[model samples]
Target: MSRKFKKVVEYTFLILLACIFIFPLIWMVASSMKPEANIPVDMGSIQSLLPSIVPSEWFQTYQELFSRFDVFQYIFNSVTYAIVVTLGSIVVNAMAGYAFSKFDFIGKKVLFGLLIALLIVPAETLIITQFTVAHDLGILNTRLAVILPMIANMFFIYLFRNFFKAIPDEIIESVKLDGANYWTIFWKIILPMSKPAIATVGTLSFILSWNDYLWPLMVLTDSEKFPLQVAITNINTTPPVYTNQVMAILTISTIPLIIVYIVAQKYLLQGLGGSGTGIK
Candidate 1:
């Protein structure tokens, strides 16, 4: 086979694969724009991938969702929760990473080893224990119950630690020699240099907090406090479940995540690349 022909074949295969992956998103957006009755009728056809031509129908599903559901409140709660958790995770995890990478405290090695071991444990396994602890602490049904448990992800801490390990000791020593304290060096020097890691962690943290349904659902009973993910599920149980509205909610819920990924794409790639090299 000619090299040019092989390249074409590979490109064709990849395009088809990309289409297969993207079809669902296309169908969703398309379906969300359609009327409830038209959705099922259009399924399994090319029309399923295209939005309704009627301009009024374009936003009718979303209009009904907003008017009927307290979607804005749910979005606000989710955004608030996500932001708080993301910031807290970055600060706490990065500090832990920096300490592990540069400090010489006792039991550090053992603690770090345990932390690394935690990476293998599935988060689902700890949900019951986490719920028990939250109940004991009287934080259940509050934002703290959701935010506190999610803020300390072991994988993120591991990522930050490995990324910090790649930094040269000489730079830290030089900063110290210039009369900078550990906090000063960490906040000013280390953090600024770790933009890629920060972007990666922050983006992932936001997504995690935003998409978290099971934990929030288990802990929170108040309808008003429920996040977008939890509240959206209520539509299924509520009478007159509209498929178009459900698709609309999902489509809307996905926007923030897509925006985050797009904005952090460059740093995410760089961070992942740097992390691979930094792992010792």
Candidate 2:
């Protein structure tokens, strides 16, 4: 095939793939609205998906779910945890990444080398170790138990390290020459220029932290402190299977993250290729 023809085919294939991925999301919304029988169908009940089409008890289902459990509180807890983790991880990882990318010091290379190695270790492998620490700290049921472990991400630091390293040394030198110190260069110059990379790490961290069930489940025993993901899990029961309720809870759980990505999409996109701007 000609180069232009191949490029067109590639883009066409990608669009189809995108539709394939997005179809499930569309179907989820559709399934959430349908009467119970319609859910098991391939396309779902078509009428329920229409915004104006209302099931008789449509509003009541949402109200019933919320009233039965403090779903709002769960949503709040999840949002709070996700936000705190995102900000903390971003700060710690960005600083670590900047240092690893810029500074030369004793053990720097070794430490970074070890960090990279740690990324290969599955988080599940350290559950016992983490549990022990949580037990010793007496914070097993607290939000802190879930929050503290994930702050300094090895992968994010490494990502920023590589991205920051691509920044020209002359920018740092120029900042230094202007009587600005290391902190100033990092805060004022480097960070603003690295929005895309920062957003990349932040977005991933938020998604993982928000959707996380096993780690949070292990740590938080209190229902009040449970994130939406945890709360959703609790709603599942064996009989009469409230599938609509389950999907409603899931749909609620998914909304804020969707809004976040929609809002931050530009920055997220920029972050992937990283930036090539002069920091100074």
Candidate 3:
């Protein structure tokens, strides 16, 4: 076949793949527009992508969601958690990463090595241990339970360390010569130059913490304390004919993530591109 034909085929395949990936989102939007009784009768499986034959009660699903739960409160809780986690993770991980990158100390290599090793350890393996600690600490039902663990993550630390490593030693040395302490160099010089990396880490952390369902389910028994995903779980357990409400909830849940990604796209792309692209 001609190269032109091959190019056309490749484009067609990619377009097909994208459509397949986005169909669920499209269906969710369609369902969110649907009336309560008209919502698709999905049995907790992968929901149907096909829109209902007739669009009906657009307001009731949202109405029911509002009545049963203070969605504003849920949104506030999610936003607060996401913001707190993102900021705390950045501060903790960036400092750790900077030290790991720029400082030479005894056992530094060993410590970094341990973090890399822990990366392979599934979080599920530690959930029970974490639960025990949380229960013992009396923070099980509070926002602290969710926000505390996220303050330090191996992956974000690694990203920060690597990003800091890519910065020239001369820059740090020069900053030090200009009467800057380690904290000053970090806050003023290193961090300003590392916006893309920080944004990347912050965005990912926000999304992960926002969408987190299992841990929240385990820790927060109070409906009032629920995050967006946890709120959706409660909505999921509602009576059988809740198609529209489920769709509405899912739609609502997806919007924050979408907005965040859109706002951070530039930084996210730069951070990802820089990740493994650096020369030692």
Top candidate on TM-score is: 1
Off by over 4 Å in 2: 1-27, 34-56, 238-241, 261-280
* Global lDDT scores for all candidate models: 0.87, 0.79, 0.81
**Per-candidate clash tally:** 0, 1, 1
Candidate 1 C-alpha error for residue 75, in Å:
1.2
Task: Encode model 3's per-residue lDDT on 62-83: one tens digit a residue.
Answer: 8877777688888988999999
TM-score of each: 0.87, 0.79, 0.82
Candidate with more favorable, higher TM-score: 1 or 2: 1
Q: What's model 2's TM-score?
A: 0.79
Candidate closest to the true structure, highest lDDT = 1
Sort by lDDT, best first: 1, 3, 2
The runs of at least 3 residues in candidate 3 whose Cα sits more than 4 Å from the true structure, single-residue gaps closed, are 1-19, 40-57, 266-280
lDDT of 1 by residue, 1-280 (tens): 6999999999999999999999999988998998988888888888888988787899999999999999998889999999999899999999998998889999998998898788777768798998899999999998888889888877787788889999999999998999999999999889999988898888878877888889999999999899988888897678899888998988888899899878777766644422233321
lDDT (Cα, tens digit) per residue for candidate 2, span 156-208: 88788888998999989988998998899999988988887888888877877
Candidate 3 accuracy as lDDT: 0.81
